[model samples]
Target: MADLVVGVGLRDGVGAAAVVTAVRSAIAEIDASPTDVVALATLDRKAAELAVVRAAAELGVPVLGFTAAELAAASVPNPSARVAAVVGTPSVAEAAAILGSGGGELVARKRARDGVTVALARTV
Candidate 1:
């Protein structure tokens, strides 16, 4: 089985439950088991966010953090101009997952819930 990476995007003060929900939702959307996930990824700025940290710990994986510029360098199937205006990137979850997976294929598109967003990519 190919290893998968889950990339996260969240607003400030998000709860761990919400993060968990988003991750589960995204992975489920792609019909992948939790064991397929190797790690979680997100903006370096939010790497230390308790929600993300807690969610990664809960998922039994380390969190890989990437800078906004690094995330912006990636090309995503779905890019949001509004997200770019806010965080200087067209996408956070999709790009982070792509970059974290070594430019791998996006297995799942972005999904939002309870103030969090998640996407999945297969490791190259």
Candidate 2:
């Protein structure tokens, strides 16, 4: 099985439960498990989001935070101008996943629910 990383983007005040649910659903699409996930990635601005920290703790994985410039450098299938305006990156979930996986392939695009967005990437 491929090693996986999940990137998350969430609105303020989102809870860990919602983050976990969204991640589970995203990885489930690829027939993967939370145990298969190596890390959770997000923009550095969200590095201190309590929900993200809790979700990573629950999944037994590290949380990787990337700067907007670093995330922007990653090539992603989906880029959002709105996100860029708000966070200085066109792609948060997909780009963070790709970067956190060390240039892995994006296996899943961003999936949004309950104000949380999740994307999956796997190292080749």
Please give the RMSD to the true structure for each candidate, in Å. 1.0, 0.9
**Cα-based lDDT for every prediction:** 0.90, 0.91
In candidate 1, what are the lDDT values of residues 57-105, reduced to their tens digit? 9989999999999999999989999999999899999999999999999
Model 2 segments beyond 4 Å from truth? none
In candidate 2, position 35 carries an lDDT of 83
Query: Which candidate achieves the best lDDT against the true structure?
Result: 2
Candidate 2 versus truth, CA RMSD in Å, comes to 0.9
TM-score of each: 0.95, 0.96
Pairs with steric clashes in candidate 2: none
Residue 21 lDDT in model 2?
Answer: 94
| 10 residues in a row with least lDDT, candidate 1 | 24-33
Candidate 1 segments whose C-alpha is farther than 4 A from its true place: none
lDDT tens string, model 2, 14-113?
Answer: 9999999999998888898888999999999787789999999999999999999999999989899999999999999999899999998888999899
Q: In candidate 2, what residue range of length 10 has the lowest lDDT sum?
A: 1-10
Compare the candidates by TM-score and give the number of the best one.
2
